[model samples]
Target chain A: MDVVKTPQQAAVTVEPPPGEPVPAIELVKIAKTFSSRRGIVTAVDAIDLVIGEGEFFSLLGPSGCGKTTTLRMIGGFEEPTEGQILLYGDDVVGVPPNHRDVNMVFQSYALFPHMSVFENVAFGLRRKAVSKAETKARVGDMLDLVQLDGKSDRRPRELSGGQQQRVALARALVNRPRALLLDEPLAALDLKLRQAMQLELKRIQREVGITFVFVTHDQNEALTMSDRLVVMNAGRIEQLGSPREVYEHPRTRFVAGFIGTSNLITGRVRAMDGSTALLEAAADECLVVPEAASAGAGVGRDLDVTVRPEKIVISEDRPGSGRCAIRGRVAEVVYLGTSTQYAVATAGGTELSVFVQNASDADDIAGRGADVWLSWRPDHSLALVTTQPAPAESRSDLSGGNQ
Target chain B: MSRSRLGARLTPYLLVLPGWLWLVVFFVVPTFVMLSVSTQTGDIVSGFQQTFHWRTYVDGWNQYHTQFIRSIVYGLITTLLCLVIAYPVAYWIAFRGGAHKSSLLFLILLPFFVSFVIRTQSWNFILSDNGMLLSALKNWGLVSQDFHILATAPAVIGGLTYNFLPFMVLPIYVGLERLDPALLEAAADLYGSKTATFRKVVLPLSMPGVFAGVLLTFVPAAADYVNAAILGGARTTMIGNVIQTEYFTNLDYPKASALSFILMAALLLGVFAYARVLGTEDVLDVAAR
Candidate 1:
């Protein structure tokens, strides 16, 4: 069977129907700083990002990472300090949010409280001077699209959170903007509703095929909804890639730790050749790291290595050749239905976690306090340049080799 | 289990008891007394023996014809005028005041720091004949030197509007302040122009505040004897002045009570009628919020 490209993977080259061929929206070196009595604070640092025609891209980061600020800049709600925002390739710098061809679904779902659902959806069409008959038909169609045909006369406050969210979605989509910017659209929902709405949002995006630039702090949400995600930290793009690529081959320690659970090891370069490098682990043990780049360290320059817990094998006996092995006492054991996780403590007083899935009728690995060997192939380990110390202090001790 | 059930059942009513008591003591009892006195033919001082003379309403009506109607009309005009002026100011404060919002709100409320009497008296100085304002208007070719505003119906209306403007401003400001800005931006993204966004989204959503403000300004303005007594000529008399006269000068307590009851009934009926037209129950709920 031939694989079809998802909206995230598909190139956003096709123009939206019924419009002049132009770039949907563009921002060049956008920067925004807020100055108050408290002092000047740079909310959105000098940044550049392009949202193309009919694309579903996402900016993923924690709060205060400037993702929402970037979206606000594109929507013309906030004027860029030193950059230009272009809609359809035209500099939209003094154009108000109303004039911009973009819309946003706020996290709180800001439906007009006094207007009925129908009136709310028809607001944009009426503004555009569309005929009354056409407005009725268009608004009716949008209501049906959002599965709210029977609720046209109902006020927003009367609706449930999920229903209000759908009404907000229909209201924005009825206008048929060039792009839809969703700022944590599902944040207000409970877990179950949020999960359901994620799929619903994906389906809606597929059906509409409009450019969607979503902003979210949730890594799981971004991974599920986005075709490609830009993981951001401290007002800079840390990495941008497909979910699997970014998850498996994270280029930075932040990306590795931010995306999913991983075991980290800090070591110093002992020796290096063209293909592989030997490193002295923090536990006074030597490790052979494969596919490792030369650190140009003579003997004691420190380096960091990241290995996933699932990649390590915990057994009474060492498994295979060219695998880094460590002897440790099992500190704790947690059986998680499908997988068994063991926290093993090495002689260096660092605790390392090893997870192995239950694939066969083998007895469970050792209990807490049992001595064992933790092993993983050198190819599965990564030797990284030791840059700044761990950005998060909680993960610092865990990064020192065996821990 | 019995204790738990009793607590659960009584807690809600207990929580609501204070407000209910307040309403009964301050509102319901006064309205009942007014109703009784309105139906009495004789004055309250002369034992009225529970005599039900409904003609008192008619007499009250006939005695104050254009003045009663004029008071209501002037109140309506002042309320409408305040709404027109306040919506934009409230919108600016609510949606665009950025960081200095508390200070801006304080400024809007600053006039209330002085007593209403003081505020009304201040207007006297400003709008007095040959006052600085009159001189400025004459200098600017807007009014003649002989033309004055302190004794006219327009002066009373102006006084009423100025006195009650803060009342109108507060509710509208509250409504506008509570508005979720993203909703406006959402409307804009849906292809609404600034005017359209305001008209369709911001205006309708803020109507609850408008409704409350209208009620606050118009009801007080309609019943206000102070502004009319201070700034109005005999031609600018309102129903409140009539009631005051009947109570004090004429010593006809029953007739004054009858007039007060009639005004209160009219206000209630008007509010109900407005709610029906605008489908404003939800707006009122939001206003309360």
Candidate 2:
């Protein structure tokens, strides 16, 4: 280990077991730039990634953040301006999509309108000149996998959007390629249908035992469905980790704000005690953070940290010295069916958001203008490594202060 | 209230009255008069009367059967030639024209700004034996002096094809435009080569346009006499020229009307057979998709 802890590189790597087989997909410094009339737009910057076999990998970010572009490059729908793409350890550069060993389910579902579901699924088998009986059996099996066996004879236009999506999936998966690329396949469906399909997709991926690379802008979708996901911003990877690791320990400011709601606070280290640092938020108040979080920095160095709302407890009295605590007046309260959300303004003029579960007829603990104490474990206040300006949304709820 | 309800019921009729009146005056009365005249018997000087003679159809068919066959053959050849020449143009404009699509389409249709007769007449200058192009080809030994294009079936067919190229291209362009490019990408992603992708997806989806173009151009091209009159000699006279001559120079109204009715019926039967063969239902379904 080096003297300096580089969380950016460590958090972004999801190491497979030792002596793992060849990766299903490997991107080596891939980049794509499109020249438009306005100017050249860098849709995807040079980035390296390796997706393990049988893993549900995701590239997630907001729209135009290069997730879809990266997926397109993997599917061979796009050619990288620079870098190599390896499929099962073979460089796939210059190979047309038809010759590639991967299939893509497009955002529009791209099902052949004139073809029946059966024919669409059988298309790849037919291209490979599979026997008629085998094509029929394989198409039947694929349709069954998608839960659309009886409807195989129907044309794509006659089916609903969700059915069309299944047909698109079946059409691609029927080929049994090394990997499957899905570009926002669930974005067109209604919310409930999308959720159902997410689980259904996971189940199908498990049953097929093929590598699945899913690209989506929906953070919750990625978090719930992906074994590991790469959070991207502005054509670059912000962080990559398993969903829990990313949600709990985001290494960058963008990842912290993008994955879920969090309160960001800027503070300066006041004292270092063994493995924890005390920050002087005010004359008599101190904010405690992991000493490892500010490891490379000396005292008086400014740092930004994030604490998830669910980790903070709201009560009437301040916590003991062992825990970090702050006093705030509840600015607003929203009753969110299972949890009550509080927006509190501290004496330091920092706004903090807190989420409390409604356990056994729980009601609003404190109304607007009522004073409340917010406390959490010292380690919960994760110090973000990247010095990027706190995202605009997090700045509105600065939480690490006790002035 | 009842009166107003009646007035509301009459609104649709009132809105359509002008169009109905125009059709009645221009189409219905002329058709009935022609039907009556088709069965009359007369000479130009001796005048004519309604004899209800039905043999006129048989007589007209027997006399100009060769010309009728020639007209159908010419029209079929022109339609096929137009399709061959227009399909690629339409595909290019629809798929690759990009920012210049509208301009390219305008260029395809630019000849329509000139009169139909003027456009057909312009071909006369191009195809004439001593014309600039043909004469130059002759002087360059590209053709024998006797190998002239003027007053031939190819000249008339070429003229009709030029006159109707846009009819073929526009419909195909509209059809190809309606096709989702994703469908093509999907075909390729499914391991279809360029040729296979075109044969399976592009050709099938563009059938509706081809069908429409065939009808729009064939119907008029078959019934047209202008190209034959200007660009053809006596050997190349079509049924349309026969009909025109019978009605105009020969002053034979009954024969002309009978021939006109025969041509109309033949075209209707031919198009009906075409529709049956191509299956408009399949084309319409593909279009809908």
Interface RMSD values, listed in order for every candidate: 1.8, 1.0
Query: Which tens-of-lDDT digit does each residue in B114-173 have in candidate 2?
Result: 999998888898788899898999999999989888789889999999999999999999
Q: Write the per-residue lDDT of candidate 2 for residues A1-403, one digit (tens) a residue.
A: 0111223223334344578787888899998877666456777778899899999999998887788889878877888999888776667777777777788898898877778888889888888788899889989999999999899889988999999999999999988988999989999999999999999999999999989999998999999999999998777788989999999998877888998898987777787777566776755455788854443544778767789999998988767777788888999999888898999998777798999999997755898999888889988988787645545643323222111
**Collision pairs in model 1:** A8-A227, A266-A401
Q: What TM-score, to 2 decimals, does candidate 1 have?
A: 0.84
List per-prediction Cα lDDT, in the order shown: 0.77, 0.86
Off by over 4 Å in 1: A1-28, A36-38, A48-55, A84-95, A129-154, A158-160, A173-178, A281-286, A294-299, A360-362, A385-403, B1-51, B125-146, B285-289
> Which portions of model 2 miss their true places by more than 4 Å?
A1-18, A283-285, A291-298, A387-403, B1-21, B43-48
Give candidate 2's total backbone clashes.
Answer: 0
Please give, for residues A1-403, the per-residue lDDT of candidate 1 as tens digits: 1112233223233344575566567667887776655455566556777667887788887777678878877777777788777666667776677666677888888787767888888877777777899889989998887788899999887888999999888877877877888888888889999899888989898988888989988888888888777877655577788777777766677777778777777666687766577776545344777766643334556666777888888888755656788778999999888888888897667678788898788687798888888888877777554334433532222212110
In model 2, the Cα lDDT at residue A375 comes to: 88
Candidate 2 chain A weakest lDDT stretch, 10 residues? A1-10
